[model samples]
Target: MIVGMNMENQVLIVEDEDSLSSYLKTELTFENYDVLVAGDGEEAMTEFTEHQDTLGVVLLDWMIPKLNGLEVLRRIRKQTATLPVIFMTARDYVGDKVAGLDNGADDYITKPFEIEELLARLRVIFRHEAQQLQVAPVYEIANLKLDTKSHQVTRDDSHVQLTQREYTLLLYLLQHKEETVTRDELLDNVWGVDFVGQTNIVDVYIRYLRNKVDRDHTPELIHTIRGVGYTLREEE
Candidate 1:
C-alpha cells in the first residue's frame, strides 16, 4: 500500500484482458491498494459513478468493449475535473496520445510497461493530489459560495450545475479571489501546460464561465479589463 495516499481510496482498473487485469489486481493488492476491476467500458462507468468519492486513480485501457477508452474518459471528465486518470494503451500513435491527454488524462503508459514504472507513476499522481486534497471551507463572494471539497457551487442557497471544465475555471477564479487573473495564467493553470489549442480558448471559457457565474446575478463578480485580463470581484 502507498504511504501518502489514503489506503481506503481505490484504484479502478478498466481492462477486458482477464490475464493482465488479474496480474495488475494482484500486484496492486499486494502493495495494499484497494482495487476495483471492470471488464468493459460500460462497467467502468458504472463502477466510477458508484465509487467516485472513494476512487483514487483510474487505469483506463484504450480499447474496450461497449465504449472506447477515449469516450469513457470524455464521459468521466463531464462529471469531475479532479479525478486522476492514467491511460494504458498499446497504440503509440501521436494522435492517440494527443487525444487522450487533451481529454484530461493525467498520464499515460504504453502497454507492456514494467510494474515498477506504473507504481512510480501512481506515486507521482498521489503526490500531486495530496497537495490539494485538504478540504477547505466554502469561498464566498457576494452571494456565490463554492465548496471545493464537494465540488459544489451555489448562489443564495440555490445549487448551480457546472460542467467539469467550467467548474475548474470557476474554482481557479475563487482561489485567486479579488485578483485579476490573466489569460496566460488561466491557460497555464486550468488548461494544463501542454495546451496547444488556439489562444482564444481562454477567452472562450471565460465567456462560458460568465454566463453561468454572473448572468442574472446581482453584484456581478466576473469583470473584464479592457487591455489586461479578468477579475472576480463583487461590484456595487
Candidate 2:
C-alpha cells in the first residue's frame, strides 16, 4: 500500500511496472512533488478517490490490471471533469490517441519518453490549474467581460464557452490589453517554458479563441499582429 505524505502537490502515478513506477516516484519526489504509486487499476482508483482533492495530476498508464487506464479515467471524469489525466502508454496509433482524448485524458505521452518532457508536461498542467484558483479582477473591453472568480466570459451579454486553456489565454490577453503579446510570451505565460517552439500550438489555440470569442461578434477582440504575435483590443 503506497501512502502519500504531503497532500499538497500530490501526483498519482498509476503504472503497473514496478521498475518504471519506482523510477518515476523517485524522480517526481526529487522535484518536490508528493508522489503516490498504484501498481494496478483498483489501487489507482482507491488512491485517487482518497486524495482527489489534493492531487494535482494523474500519470496513468494505459495497460493495467483489473481496469485499464481509460476505464479509470472514465470513472475519474465522472467525478471531476476538469481533473487533469495524462496517459503514459506505448500505444502510438491515432485511434488510440483519439480514444484516450475523447475519454477525458488531458494529455497523451508515448512510452520510452524523456523524463524531462514528462516533468515539463506535468508542470504545464499544474501551472494552468493554479491559474484557475487565482482571484482575478473583472475585466472589460468594450462589450466583452470576463469574471475570473466566476470563470465566465460574456460578449454583448452572451456567454461564451471556453476551454481551460482558452480561458487562460484570454485572461492573459485582457490583462495586457492593447499590447502585442509575442508568441514566445504567450507560450511562456500560457503554455509554460516547455512548449517554447514545439510546433505552432500557440497559433492553433489563438484560432480556437478567435472562433469562439470573435467569430460572430463585430469588432474583433483578438487581432493577429502579422509576423509578431497577437493582441486583444477594441477595434480602432
The number of the candidate with the highest TM-score is 2
Count clashes in each candidate, considering only residues at least 3 apart in sequence or on different chains.
2, 0
Q: After superposing candidate 2, which stretches have Cα over 4 Å from the reference?
A: 1-7, 38-50, 64-81, 92-108, 127-135, 154-161, 215-219
Please, what is the whole-model Cα lDDT of each candidate in the order they appear? 0.78, 0.81
Q: Give per-residue CA lDDT, model 2, range 4-71, as digits (tens).
A: 11225789999999999999999999999999999999999999889887887899999999999999
Q: After superposition, how far is residue 119 of candidate 2 from its true place, in Å?
A: 2.9
Q: Write the per-residue lDDT of candidate 1 for residues 1-236, one digit (tens) a residue.
A: 11122223579999999999999999999988899999999999999889887888899999999999999998987777657788999988878876886676756788888898888767655543554466656788989998865667888788776654566678788889888888888877765664445567678667777877788888888888767788889872
Angstrom error at residue 232, model 1: 0.7
TM-score of candidate 2 against the unseen true structure: 0.70
How big is the positional error of residue 123 in model 1, measured in Å on the Cα after superposition?
Answer: 7.6
**How many backbone clashes can be found in candidate 1?**
2
